[model samples]
Target chain A: MIDLRELYQEVILDHNRQPRNFRVPEHPQRQAEGYNPLCGDKITVYVHVDQGQIRDVSFKGAGCAISQASASLMTEAVLGKSLAEARSLFEGFHHLLTDEGSGPSTGGDLGKLEVFSGVREYPMRVKCATLAWHTLKSALEDESATVSTESPNPTPSGGP
Target chain B: MVKTEATLVAPSLDPGLLRPDFPALDQKIHGHPLVYLDNAATTQKPTAVLRALDRYYRRDCSNVHRGVHTLSQRSTASYESARGIVQRFLGSSSDREIVFVRGATEGINLVARSFLGPRLEPGDEVLVTAMEHHANIVPWQLVCKAAGARLRVLPMDDRGELRLEELGKVLTERTRLLAAVHVSNALGTVNPVEELVAAARQRGVPVLLDGAQAVPHKAVNVEALGCDFYVFSGHKAFGPTGIGVLWGRREHLETMEPYQGGGDMIVTVGFEGSTFREPPARFEAGTPNIAGAIGLGAALEYLEELGLPQIEAYEAELLSYATQRIGSLPGIRLIGTARRKAGVLSFVVEGVHPHDVGTILDQRGVAVRVGHHCAQPVMAHFGVPATVRASFAFYNTRFEVDALEQGLREVKEIFGP
Candidate 1:
């Protein structure tokens, strides 16, 4: 059995150590920030969409290893998928982290997001891991313009 | 005769020799040596306190004051004896002045309700420091609203030290009370309670000190400081939870009304109207935490034997060493720089959020408190939402400080320069 203390596996820490696409886009379509001020977890989600398919994705900010690694992994999972598919994964990951479902394996194609199932046991860290997804969801909604690391208020739509 | 100071004549207590007293210190965390640094929040109970907890429940368990049975008598004796021990520890005038509440929060709330409720008038102002824990802040809000009193703040500098000049300006003829922390749990700045109380006393305004952080770290005398009220939690002082002490002046305790209506707190209850018990009994209304009280008393005895002065001397060295090491790290910004402090370091590394620093530290088996620490006012003052706080205890050593430094260094190497 995996030691409970080593809750974040070596792979997750490695991803956090060398985060993937941890930069703002050279030119971006929509940018949104996600913050969990209680734990001081902050992240900026940047997205690029062309028609229905996600053209590119990137993120920047700092938080716990779970959050940074989850953002890295999230970028890899959602890069080529449609906006609808990305939303579905976000929902599926939320369900997995909150332990609301019977482990979303056969139904929702959560991809590498399934590696985060162990996060449920440590409820405090769940917010750390989900910070990125919340940021990504803001970008997908086509509403929020700037993501703040200070406030938890969900961003209003991109429109006036 | 002058009361003898415990640590003044006592020799230094070795943390190594004392390590075995606490059972939890022996455990490992994250494949490394467990370095528990979160003591300002609460301390790990020593074996003596643990034994007291068990012995009371297993052997001497019974209702107090009411029963004539042997168990009840034994339990009552132990409970009252514990109160006497706490009374002496706090330099209280008498045991009757010490009332056990839930914790420091409840203690502050009790005074705000019982004492402040009767005297405060409309437009009278209650002064609180910007560094107050939500516990200290929220209770005064209730009292202020009830009496139509205004609540003002004693501002602080960047280091979270109370603005004494602001305090002088704030305390006027209209000021009723000045309630502030003896030590900031988030920042580790130790307030000069003597100076603070002296200023308030000049204007005849009462001062209530939140001594939650001060009691465990150093010697505290209510009379010497000349504060009207002092409060703290048992868990923070190496005792069991669910029990705390509130020490108020005798006159105030006698004048204040009873907090709750129940069994032991009543002298005589009538069908026409209820007659309340006097002073402390009037305030404490219910079956108290008998075993917890016994544990608290034992905890005090343990501290006495170890000698608080030696503990203070040893912890001061630890704080200095830790402060120096933390100050040298690249991109690490220390938040509070008060001339005097307890054992807390609240800081955030550049390009890294406080949560990230906390997680990184946890990976190395160093436990610390992260986030606002229930002091959002301080956070707001700093213009940040939270901070990563590493609070030390008397038992913590330089090795733990080294481990924390190494952990942060690893975070720096991983994230950026």
Candidate 2:
């Protein structure tokens, strides 16, 4: 059984307390809203791309500690990365949270994102941890539709 | 003004003795003894209910109303007997008044489509309380939308009590029917159904009471309440799922059309059309959950044997104990503080989202419901995205409340200031 301490780490708690880039960027080029109807978690991800590089990334939402902290950490991780790199990071983070076999050590270049490996133990909370990344993916793809986690077939525009 | 100790009022039935009746309550989750507090969602079944289901499937398993064999006769007898139990449970005059549907949702839908749907005119309105479960609200919205009628809401106060003073203003000539929840699932406010029914009757408007949250914790007599229809889910009352009671007045059920077309609902078949059966049979349009009904009957019998009045008294003290204990905690804000409530306690911890509180609680084997509770409007009214709800059952004890309190403190500790 996964301990509560593992899931609610000091780092995750700190990010939740003072979420970094916790606002919509000025004149955001790409933005999308994500919602998890299960828990009523809502998140909007804003991204500004400059010359194939993410100039800024930010989010604003109301959710549990996992979702808010994940969003905060995501902004910090993908701030300066290229679009492809950011998508890859989302993939790696998703793998870390979903694949039980994929531990923190196995998550390549995940850095602080690996702290969420504990979330995999609580299957219900995986969606909470991944809501931000899914929203970020939608924002990156410039999807106009609001992403919902309950969507049956989630494509590039699909939510967590 | 919080009382640290249990109230002076003694519980008629001791929960300690009754706890053994429910086998599910005797287990552990995550190494800690299970503290199941999510009773409003669904209750754990007692041994009696379980035995009824087992006995039905094991020995007297057969289809009802059409079977001529001994097994079929037995099954049919049991099924109809369950209806009689429900009729008596609701204090309805006849078994024909009790129509067994899937659950409270289906019961409301049946009324919306069959009874209220056809009577609604272009400008007619259906008045519902603001604190109703979505099961009550959405069906009316659907029926109203299709019939070009309007759906009006009777608002509630900050305490989650309905604004009874505005009832006269809200009930206009255009109001075709008044539907309300007897007890709120999210907020534990017990609406004054008697007064609401009297007011509606004065205007010659019919009333439907959603008793899903009301039936489990208290005694509900549909006739006494004077509502046109009283609907409730069986599962919430320690019965089986997929079985519920929709008790309507004889006059209304006699005239209302059948909600569905299938076997066991028809008296005769013809090429073009068929003649339908009377009241209860007209509404139950399928094979009908035979075993589920028997199980539900046994569950209701169990409650009756335990005595609803005693159960109510016991639960009242339990709720008071819980309120005083949880309410006194620092940073804990009780969402629903209605003067009169039953089984539910909704709250939000300071600077902590409800989901986090729920997760931490679950880890400590204190099961709670956290979210909009299918009542997003209630959450909206309270200016919250969601709330952590710790509902009670008669079998629940103060020991479990202590576990919940301890778990909540751990949540505050983890998410430190």
Candidate 3:
């Protein structure tokens, strides 16, 4: 009983069509690459964090609607927040997209980002919705290493 | 030739009649009748194969060749009979040549380790095509890396056809093996394997054909094809998973070292030294997938009853219909357009990602694969990240192709034309 409208909302599609922060920063303090080898969806997240406060966040890659929109939405959510706030938002967004109990918690402080709450219904697209966030985490933690969602159990048929 | 040509104009068997045999095909998905076009990934099983699996589990569920009990004997007989069936299906010289593996991946791995592992030396070469699946490529790369051999790839044109002229230039004295795909899983390019085999043979190089995508769609006579080794997964051919066949020439199988070591593969066990059995048993060092083998036997029987010629011809018609239907779209660009293609249609819309295409199609109850298709080199060749793949089987119909076309139209609307 998954709702396609919920998954592909107008806002989500708008973000996918023309993503925000879809560029790599000229001079970024931290950056890391994330790869979903399943669908060849790769993203490089670059952040210009100044003294623990996030200054700029952007990404460059190719992926599906969910992944591209998620990346766009993620940049907007974390741009002015502090590193701590960004990390917290990452957790909140991850929870929202993966909580299989009652589906993604839409009514929360997740803000406009709650539009992606329907992604929880499609387990295959969870990876797509979280690709940018994982890269952002990797960029914050270790800029040298690239992040990958190629877990022991890969997505069936390499869903993006 | 006349039979094949005649079938192109008229399908031999009514696909609707065969459709009922596959119980899974009679279901609904996303509130619509499921249109399974992802047979390249795996095919739905027929009732006969399912019944065989059920019968084996209910009546004869015992370890093979280990016990003197009646159940053991029955199970052993059934398992051995399955091997014979596979041997006949592939037109191999003997049942002893058929070795049951976990799947095509394992079968290729077995050959890479058992046959090519020992013979490869420094400066030696293993020639392959640009269109090979990862199953064929990775194992050879691992073996060549360990053995200090280099892998040479034959190029393909924009139409996804392999450049056979380059074969002569690449086939030098150091070339030890020629492993190729009988049918390209990603591009649907059916390689001229007999010609390739003959070329390899002239230079005294043994060849292995990864027939995973070919065996299910066409009549594969290994004897007529003149390949030294051939492998295919059972699940792709409407049989069960965890079961595949690795058929090799008697000379190669007899001389190769055992790929694995365990109880069943051995003739005598000792702390000092243990002797092994002949070709098939020596290679199949496992409590093999007994039920899977029996199910595969049943699947082969189903195919035999339908007749391979009829199935091939029927699928060819479906392939043509699908290709024409999908290729005629406004913004669609087909990735693979080889003249001799099997049941695969890989393509991309102008600005839409294949994943999006797949999602929209899935919403309409049309199943397809969208990814690098484990053929990243092919993706790189096409200069695209991925393409949506709709692979057909004997059970697919023209109606499903229409569904796919309509699904693509919806995708165009979603992304905006």
Candidate 3 residue spans exceeding 4 A from truth: A101-108, A151-160, B1-11
Is 1 or 3 the stronger prediction by lDDT? 3
For candidate 3, the per-residue lDDT at B363 reads 91
lDDT of 1 by residue, B1-417 (tens): 111243366566678888899999998776888889889878999999999989998999998988999999999999999999999999988999999988899999999998897889999999998888888999999989988999998899997788888776888899999898999988888988899899999999899999999889888889898999999999999999999999999988898888877988887788988888887888878899888889999999998887778777778778888888988888878888888887788887876667667766776788888788888889888877677788888888889899999989977765555
lDDT of each residue in B369-397, candidate 3, tens digit only: 99998999999999999999999998999
Q: Please give, for residues A46-65, the per-residue lDDT of candidate 3 as tens digits.
A: 98878888889899999988
For the predicted complex of model 3, DockQ is 0.53
Badly placed stretches (over 4 Å) of model 1 are: A1-37, A40-87, A95-107, A111-122, A131-160, B1-10
Q: Pick the winner on TM-score between candidates 1 and 2.
A: 2
Task: Give per-model TM-scores.
Answer: 0.84, 0.97, 0.96
Give DockQ: model 1: 0.25
lDDT of 2 by residue, B1-417 (tens): 222122354346888999999999999899899999999999999999999999999999989998689999999999999999998888989998999999999999999999999999899999999998889899999999999999999999999999999987899999999999999999989889999999999999999999999999888898889999999999999999999989999999999998999988999989998999997899988899999999999999999998887788878888888998999999999998888899999999999999899889998999999988889899999999989999999999999999999999999899996
Ranking by lDDT: 2, 3, 1
Q: Pick the winner on DockQ between candidates 1 and 3.
A: 3
* True-structure lDDT of candidate 2: 0.90
